[model samples]
Target: MLDLPSILNLSGGPVGLFIGSFLASTLLPGGSEAMLVWELQQHPDQAILLCSVATLGNTLGGLSSWLIGWWLGRRYPGRGLSNERQRLALKRVTHYGSPILLLSWLPVIGDPLCLAAGWSGVRLLPATLFIGLGKALRYGALAGAMGSLG
Candidate 1:
């Protein structure tokens, strides 16, 4: 059983990983990959737990961003995307719908894709499901890869 120090030792373990993953999944300017990788290296036995926690945290963060976009869509009915970049993003997601959320794990545009889906009024359940799937797959792959680093 891991304790607080296990979580706090290397800039916080699983808990810290959850928080970092959550923020990184948002539009915020941060990346949890470094911390995640470091933690995985330190605690190889906890890989599944760590990855699951990260995925959950990240999915929640993506949902927060999606909900914000939904709120914006509600708050500003007629006021659509303010700029060309957002417009283009809206176009891409609109072309594919919820399935496009598979790319929500992408680097630069992933968060915006979720935002676009919300702004464009994509269904909530499917979008959230796809987002979670994409994130889980990403974490699974990363952790699987990390398993070989020993």
Candidate 2:
């Protein structure tokens, strides 16, 4: 059966990272951390490049999720937080404001949070800024940790 790792291998290189990061940010289940670490280890000098690409892709993916909510949310009310899991996933988003999007880098709640922000009427500019910054910071920390490994 196909999986995220296999797909990443197929799309290899910086492009793969972009793809992987994008997939990871969407509702789809994925994890770009391994690819980020592997790429950084393979070419430490390209840390900035890899991190930037991944962050950009992930941010765009988050934006896409937001847009989905912005447009379709009204049509399909509660779709963004349909069930108990999503309700729990969106707890922080409901409690906090758009800036809470800074935690958009998180795993389970991350994607739903982005969607909830748009569905809840969070503006696009702030959403993009917070999502991009959060994703970039996560990648930066990952790269830094990998750098210190060897």
Candidate 3:
């Protein structure tokens, strides 16, 4: 039986990094940071390429969540809050608007932030920009730290 990292390692390098980062940004449980650090350590020269790829993949994954929320908003229109989670998400999105998506890189609330942005009818361009920026900053920071150590 192969462990998760072992299995991911078999996928190899940047391609694996992209896949891992994408999944990590989704609702699915995953950790791309380790794979990213491993990849950077192995190929420090390709740091920019790796970080760009991870950011793009992760951004797309977040967009997927946003799309789901868009659909939910369209479907329900004016549905009442079903729970505290929905209430908070709606409140935040309405109050802060698309700029709030800057926090979409956060672990627990990140995905939901994207979802709320979509559900609130936050325009796609701004949502994409903020989400991409946030994820890029995170990957950049990680790569920078790895570079300093290496």
Candidate 4:
């Protein structure tokens, strides 16, 4: 008879919220916005803290994807992308550079964008900055919308 929402709200807490957001920022289809909004509503005083934590967690997740691509590039050596479509994707990422990593906060293609940035050998610091900025903007926007709703 336990309500699922209530159970999640209780078990997740703040740190759990951050972890969920981190995982969601990866290739996973999960989303942390709902949990964040719920936590914000329940603990308005901690809104800023929660937002920062979520952003950091998400940024780290994006960084993980980037690192994975970088590692893969090293592992594969001269194998190249193997297809025209992949070659085009690599070309675009290489042409665009770190700024393209800002799109990493988007849904679906976001995680892949980060990975592409790495595979293209974009500078790590710049890529991280762009990814962090994008995630911060996304979390800020979601928080703003949720605040307005309540």
Candidate 5:
């Protein structure tokens, strides 16, 4: 007797939230905000667990893009930025280093930032820290907003 929203909203736990968050953080076209909000609405007591799960999934997805960039860097050492977007991402990554990953939760440019950080050889530890922190903050903010609304 479960409805579509019930299923998509992950009535069991935060597992679907994790998967949706992961795909959302990647270059893939999707988002987990709705799912997060729904999960929060369903399990108000488990806000921390839901946000943490979402952040972890999102951070890993960003790292996956970083890994792809690392492989690409090794494969094509002489590759050039083919467009303005890539050039801008590289410029920001080079100028700000892994600290720029604090903005990795942003859409449109977030995925590029992760890739550029890896391509420019930003240290994994710092990148992971910043990416996770940024994602955690975002989810925290969302939970806070939900708390206020409800």
Candidate 6:
């Protein structure tokens, strides 16, 4: 039988946990929070490193989704989006600008939000900054919660 505690600890380690969490943040469905918290409990000394890796991994995954969206936008040229929907989404993005990225921390919609931003041809630098900020906030929150519980 697999040792659940050991498995959790390993999965939550700096490299393994980061990769898993990062991939999960993309279109794929997975989550690393439990592993992260478990690792924090098991290895307090590694909390900061774990948190940083998780955040960077997640950000890169989100960026991958954004790149996919950007590429699709170029190839498809908004073919799938209705004019009205495009207009409305565009208006929201334009009005709110980078702040909309804060919502990227949300569950189902968060990944799509990043994708949509790229699809909308949002400025690359601003989009990257906002995504990074949102991802950092998420990791910080998770780390804080884990610290409290630990």
TM-score of each: 0.88, 0.84, 0.87, 0.83, 0.88, 0.79
Model 1 bad stretches (over 4 Å):
1-10, 148-150
Checking candidate 3 for backbone clashes, the offending pairs are none
Predictions in order: lDDT: 0.84, 0.83, 0.85, 0.80, 0.86, 0.74
State the lDDT of candidate 2 residue by residue for 1-150, as single tens digits. Answer: 769667566556788989998999998989988888878878788889989989998999999888876776678875656766555645766688888899889988788888878777789999999999999989988888777323
lDDT tens digits, residue span 13-36, model 5: 687888889989888978877888
Task: Give per-residue CA lDDT, model 3, range 37-58, as digits (tens).
Answer: 8888888888889889889989
Error of 6 at 75 (Å): 0.4
Model 2 CA RMSD to the hidden true structure, in angstroms: 5.1
Model 4 C-alpha lDDT per residue in residues 50-150, reported as the tens digit of each score: 88888888999989888877887888968776556446556767888788777788777787777777777887899889999998888788888777323
Q: Return the lDDT, model 1, position 44.
A: 84
Poorly placed runs, candidate 6 (over 4 Å): 1-10, 82-91, 148-150
Error of 6 at 127 (Å): 1.7
- Report the number of clashing residue pairs per model: 2, 0, 0, 0, 0, 0
Indicate the worst ten consecutive residues by lDDT in candidate 4.
81-90
The predictions' CA RMSDs to the true structure, in order, are: 3.3, 5.1, 4.2, 4.6, 3.7, 4.6
Choose 4 or 5, whichever is better by TM-score.
Answer: 5
